[model samples]
Target chain A: MCGIAGRILNAPGRVGNDLVELMDAQEHRGADSTGFAVYGIPRDSGYILRGMGFNKARLDSDLEEFRLLLKEHGSDFLEDPTFVTSDAAHYCARMVISDPKDLAGWVKDADTISDSFEVQSCGRSLEIVKDTGGAVEVADKHGVRDMIGTHGLGHARLATESSVLPNASHPFWARPFSDVAIVHNGQITNYFTWRDRLHRLGYRFLTENDSELIAVWVSHEMSQGLTMEQALKLSIKQIDGVFTYMIARQDGIGFAKDRYAMKPLVVVWQDGEFAAATEEQAVRRIYPGESEVINYDGPSITEIWGVGNRRAAA
Target chain B: MSEIVIDVGQRPIREINEEIQTACKTAKPIVVRNTLSRHNLGIGLPPGVDITFEGSVGYYCAGLNTGATVTVEKNAGWAVAEGMSDGFVTVGGYAGMSCGAAMIGGLIHVKGNSGPRCGVAMKGGNIVVEGKIGYQSGFMSHAGKIIALGGAGESCADALWQGEVWVAGEIDSLGVDVNVVEPTAEEVAEVDAILDPLGLVDTSRNWRKMISGQRLWYFESRDANAWLMI
Candidate 1:
C-alpha cells in the first residue's frame, strides 16, 4: 500500500507545510521513502531543476558534464547548483537554468547521462524534494516545510514493483513535461506493456516503478491534443490496473480511478481550497476543523480541481 | 445511569482502547470525544456495552465487535465493522468501503451512503443502508442480506453465493452471473422484521431482490468435491 496526497491553497502560501502534514499523517501507509513535489512561485525566464546524482563522490564531474550539456542546448545555469549531500551515496541538486531552446530535446539528451545524473523535475514552479526517510525526516532535510506554492503533491512509497532507492521514490515528474507531476496509490498491472509502447515512442522512464509509467502515459495523451479532463477519463478505459492517481500542473490537480475502484481518495474541496489523500485521516491534518469529506470511491471516476488564478498549458 | 466521557485526542490507540474496555465493564453509556478520524478506535468490545463516537472516525473503528452497541456521529472509514460476529454498528453519516466485510452476525445501519463493497464476503447478518450503496456493493457474499433503500451504484450484488441483495430504488447496473428475482411475501416480511426495529419498513415499494445465478458456485462446487481426503 502507498499514500498519495495533494494540496491546493486558496493563494500562494505555505503549501509545502500542509503537504508535509498530509504525508506525515499517512506515514504508516508506506514509510519506505517520502517525497514532495512543491510548486513554488512560477518564474518567467528560468526553469527550476531538481536532479539527483547517483554518486556523491563524483558530484563535481557529473555536474560539469551536465553544465556542458545545458550550454550545448542554448541554456546556461543562472547560478551554481546547490547540493544536498547525505550519508547515502546519492545527492540531490537544485539549479535555476534558462529555458532550453527545445525542452524535449534537452530532456532526451539529459536522460543519456541519467545513469549517473538524473533530473527529477524541471518546471517554472514545480520542485520535487524527495529522500529515503519518513515525512518529517525528508521535510527537515530539504526544508520542505518552508516552501511556498499554489499547489503540490506528496507520496509515501512502499516499493512494490521496484527497488527502495531514493531516486525511485515519488512524486514522479512527467519527464520533458514541465510543471507536471503525479502521485499514485495503486499498482499498474499493464505497466510493462505500455512502457514498451511509450518507450518505442521516445518517452524515457527513470524507474521501474509502475507509477512512473502513469505520469508519462497521461502526459503523452495530453500532448496528443487531449485536454487533462479528456486524458484522465480515457485512462480509466486504456490503463488496466487498480489505481487512483492525482496528477498536478501549475494551474490545478486532476485525478482518475481505475475500473475496480480498489484505491481510495478522500477530499475536502471547500472555500476555494482543496486537499486530497489516500485516506481521510491524512486529509484531517490539513482541515483540522470540521469539514465535509468527498469520497471518490467509485469506479472509472475522474475529476479536475482548478487551482488559483494560474494558467497552465493544459 | 451516569455517562462516561473518553477523550481520544492524539493519544495512543492502545491506551484509549484499554480505557474503553475498562469503561465497558461499568455498563454505562460511553461517549468518545475529539476523535480526529483516527483509525482503530474501538475493536472487539464485549456484550452489553454502548459507545458513541463524536465525530468522523478512521478505518476499523468498531471492527471485530461482539455485541456492543456502537455509533459514529459522522463519517466512518474503511471496514467499519469488519470481521464482526455480533454487534450493532450505526453510522450516523457515510461509511467507507467494505462496511460490513466478512461479518458473521450483526446489523450495520448506515444512515448515509456506503462506499464500495458494502457487505463484501459477509457470511451472515444484514446491512441496511438508507442512502445508495456504492459500486459493487454485496460482492461475493457467502450468505446474509444487504438492503439498500436509496438505490445502488454500478455492478450491484456482483457474483453472489446464496447471499441476497434487496434494493428499493434504481440499480445502476447488475453484476455478472446475478439473477434478479421477485421476492415472495414471506421473504419480504422477513426483511421487514429486520428493518422494523430501525423504523424503516415501507410497503407500496418496488423491490428488486438479487441472488447468485448459481453459475459461479458450480465450478467451485466441482473443485470442492475433488478435495484431498487428508
Candidate 2:
C-alpha cells in the first residue's frame, strides 16, 4: 500500500507546505520512502535536473560527472547546481541546463554513467525530489515546504513488492516526456505483459517497478495524440489492477481508479482549489474548515483540473 | 450534567482525544468543537459517556466504540462506528464508505446519504441510513439489522449470511445468494423498534427483507444449478 496526495490551485501559488503536510498526514500508509512532483513557473530556455544518488560521496562525484557530460554535449549550466544530503543512503541535487530540448538525451547518458546515479525528474517546470525516509524528513532535507507550484503530487511508498531504493520511489517521471509525473496506490496485476508491450514499442524502462509502467504507458498514449483524460480513460480499461493513481502535468492534474474501485480516494474542492488523497484526513489538513469532502466513486472514475482555472472535468 | 468543551482547532488532536478518553472514564459529557475533518476522533471510547462533535470528521470517527453515545453535527468520513461493539453514533450529514463496518453490537444512524459498503461484515447491531446508500451495502453480513429509507445502490446485501436488511425504497439489484423475503410480524416489529426512537414512522412505503439463501454451503450432485449458484 502507498499514499498519494495532490493539489491544484486555481491560481499559481506555493503548494510546497500543503503537499508536505499532506504527505505527513498520510505517513502511516507508507514510511519506506517519500517524494514530490511539483510544477512551478517555467524558465525561458532551460530545464531543471533533479536527481538522487546512493549517498553523499557518490552524489558529489555524480554531479561533477554530470556537469562534464553537459559541457561535452554543448550544454551549459544556468547556475551552479545545489546538492543536499537527505540521509546516509540518499542525496538530492538540482541544476538548470541551458538547453531544455537536450534533457532526454542528457538523462539517458547520465543513467549510463553509473547504476547508482538516477535522474528523478527533468522538465521546464517540473522538479521531483524523492528518497528513502519519512515524509517530514524528506521534505525538510529537500526544502519541500518552501517549494512554489500551481499544482503538484506527493507520494509515500511502503515498498511492498520492490526494494527500498531511491529508484523505486514514487512520483515517477514519464521519462522522455517532460513535465509529467505519477503517484499510484495498489498493484498492477498485468505489469509484465504491458511492460513487454511497451518495450517492444521502443520504450526504454529504467526501473523494474510496476508503477513506472503507468508513466510510460500514459506518455506513450499522449504522444499518439490522446489527451490526458482520454489516455487515463483508456488506461482504466487496459490496466488490470485495483489501483488509484494521480498524474500531474504542466497544464493540469488528474486521477483515476480501476474498475474494481478497491482503493480509496477522497476529494475536496472549495474556492477554486482542489485536494485529493488516499484518505480524507490529508485533504482536511489543507482545507480544515467548512469545505465539503466528496468520495470519488471508482469503477473507471476520472477527474481533472487545469492549472489556474476552474475548468474541471469529471 | 457537567460538560467539557474541546476546541480541536486550538488544541492538538492527540491532546483532545486524550482528554476525551480521560473524561469518558468518569462518564462525563464532552463537546468537541471545530473538528474540521480530523481523523480518529472519539474512537475506542468507554461506556456511559456522551460526546458531541460540532463539525465534520475524517476517517474512523467513533470507531470501536463500546457503549458511548457520539453525535456528529456534520458529515463524517469513512468508517464511522466501525467495529463498534456497543454505542450509538449519529451523523447529522452524509457518511463515507464502510460506515458501521464489522460492527458487532450497538446502533449507528446516518441522517444523509452514506457511501459504499455500509454495514459491511456486520456481526450484530443495527444500522439506519435515512438517505441513499452506495453500492454493496451489507456485504458479507453475518447477523444484524440494516434499514435504508432512501433505497440502496447496486448489489445491495451481497453475500449476506443470516442478517436482516430492510429497505423502504427501490433496490438497484440483489447480490449473490440473496433473496427478497416477506417481512414477518416479528421482523416488522424489530424495524419499528429501531426507527421509533428517532421519531420517524413511515407506513406508506413498502419494505423488503433480504436474506441469504443457504444453498451455497453444500454441493448437491442432483441439483446442477446449485453448483452454479455457489
Candidate 3:
C-alpha cells in the first residue's frame, strides 16, 4: 500500500514542511520512495524546472545539449542551473528559465534526453522533489521542509506495478500541463490500455508508474474543456481501478475515489486551512486537539477544496 | 476502584499497550487520554476489564477483544472490533469501514453512521448501528446479524451468505442475490433482543430482513449468461 497526502494553507506558508510531517507519520505504509509536490507563490515571468540526471559525470554535456534545445524554443536559462549531488551517480538539478515559444514542442524535444537527464516538473510555482528513501531521508536530501507554498501534495510509494526507480516515484507532474500534479494510492488496472491510447495521441510518459498516467489523463480531460470538478467525477467512471487520488493545481486541490472505495481519504479542515491523508493519524499531526474529521468513505466520491481567503472547511 | 489513566500522546503503540496490559492485571478501570486517532490501541484486551478511549480512535482500536467492555468517546477508524470472540464495544460517534469484520462473537453498537461494508466477511456477531449504514453493509457474511435503525446506503447486503441484515428505514438499493423478506415475529423479537441493551428497540418500525438467494452457491462457469447477472 502507498500513502498520499495534501495540504492547503491560508497563505503561502510552510506547506512543504506540513507535507513532510504528513508523509513521515505514514512512512510505514511505504518506505520504497518519498516525494513531494510543492506549489510556491506564482511567478508571472520565468518558470522553475526540477529534474534528475542519471550520471553526474554526464551533467555538463547533457545540460549543454539541453540548453541548445531551449534556445531553439526561443527560451534560455534565466539563471544558472544548480545541482544537488552526492555519492550516488544520479543528481537532481533546479533551473529557472525564460518562457518557451511552444511548451509542448519543447517538452517533446526535452524527452529526447530523458534517458540521461529527465525533467520531473516545470511550472511557474510547482516544484516536485522526490528520491528513493523514506520521508526524513529524502526531505534532508532535497530540503523539502523549508519550501514555501500555498498548497501541495505528498506521496510514499511501495513500487507495486513497476520497478523501484527513483524517477518512478510520485507525485508525478502532469507533463505538458504546467503547475499540475497528482498523488495516488491504488493501482490503475487499465492504465496500460489508456497509456497506449494517450501515447497515440502524442502524450509522453516518463515512467511506468500508474500515477503518472492519471496525472496526464486528468489534465487531458481538463484541457478538453472539462472543469476540474467534472474531470474528477469523470475519472471515477472512465478509469478502471481501486484508487483514491488527489490532483493539485495552482488554485487548489481535488480528489476522486474509484467505484469500490478501496482506499481511504481522511480529511481535517480548520481555520481556513486543509489537511488530508490516506489515514486519520497522519492528519492528526496537523491538528493535535480533538477535531472533527470527514471520511470520504463511500463509493464514487469526488471533492474539490479551494485555497483562498475565506474558510474552506468541509 | 480508582481509574488508571494512560496517556497515548506520540508514545509508541507497543509501550502504551504494554502499560494497558499491566493495568488490566490490577482490574482497575482504564481510561486512555490524548489518543490522537492512533491505530492498534486496546487490541487483544482481556476479559472483565473496563476501558474507555477519551477521543476518536484510529484503526483496530478494540480489535480481538475477549469479553472486555470498551467504549470510544467519539468516532473510530476502520475495523473497530475485528476478530473479537466476545466483547461489548461502543462507538459514541461514527465507525469507519468494515466495523466488525471477521468477528466470531461480539456486540458492536455504533451511535452514528457506519462506513462501507460494516460487517463484511464477518462470521458471527451482532452489529447495531443507530444511524445509517454505508454502502454494502453486509457483504459476504458467513453468519451474523447487522441491524440498522436508520436508512441503508446503496447495494445493501451485497452477496450475503447465511447472515441476516435487518433494516428499519429506507434502503437505497438491494444487492445481487439478496432476498429481502418480511421478518416473522420471532425474528423481529430476536433483533429486538440484540438492540434492547442499547435502548434502541422500536415496536412501530417496519423491518426488512435480507438473506442470501443461493444463486451464487451453485455456479456454472460455462454458462456466460449466469455471469452477466451481476
User: How much lDDT does each candidate structure score?
Assistant: 0.91, 0.83, 0.91
TM values, all candidates: 0.97, 0.89, 0.97
Task: Please give the lDDT score at residue B35 for candidate 2.
Answer: 81
Ranking by TM-score: 3, 1, 2
Q: What is candidate 1's lDDT per residue for B76-188, written digit by digit as tens? A: 99999998899899999999999999999999999999999999999999999999999999889988999999999998988777889999999999887789999999999
lDDT of 1 by residue, A56-163 (tens): 999999999999999999999998889999899999999999989999899999999999999999999999998889999999999999988889999998888889
What docking grade applies to model 1? Answer: medium
Instruction: Quote the true-contact fraction of every model.
Output: 0.79, 0.43, 0.86
Assess candidate 3 and give its lDDT.
Answer: 0.91
Report iRMS (Å) of candidate 3: 0.6
Question: Which regions of candidate 3 deviate over 4 angstroms?
Answer: A309-314, B222-230
Error of 3 at A39 (Å): 0.6
Q: Compose the digit string of candidate 2's lDDT tens values, residues B89-191.
A: 9999988888999999999999998887889999999999998777778888898988999998877887778887789888887777788998987778779
Consecutive 10-residue window with the lowest summed lDDT within model 1 chain A: A305-314
Of candidate 2 chain B, the 10-residue stretch with the lowest lDDT total is B221-230
Docking class of 3: high
> Model 3 over residues A10-72: C-alpha lDDT tens digits?
977888899999999999999999999999888898889999999999999989999999999
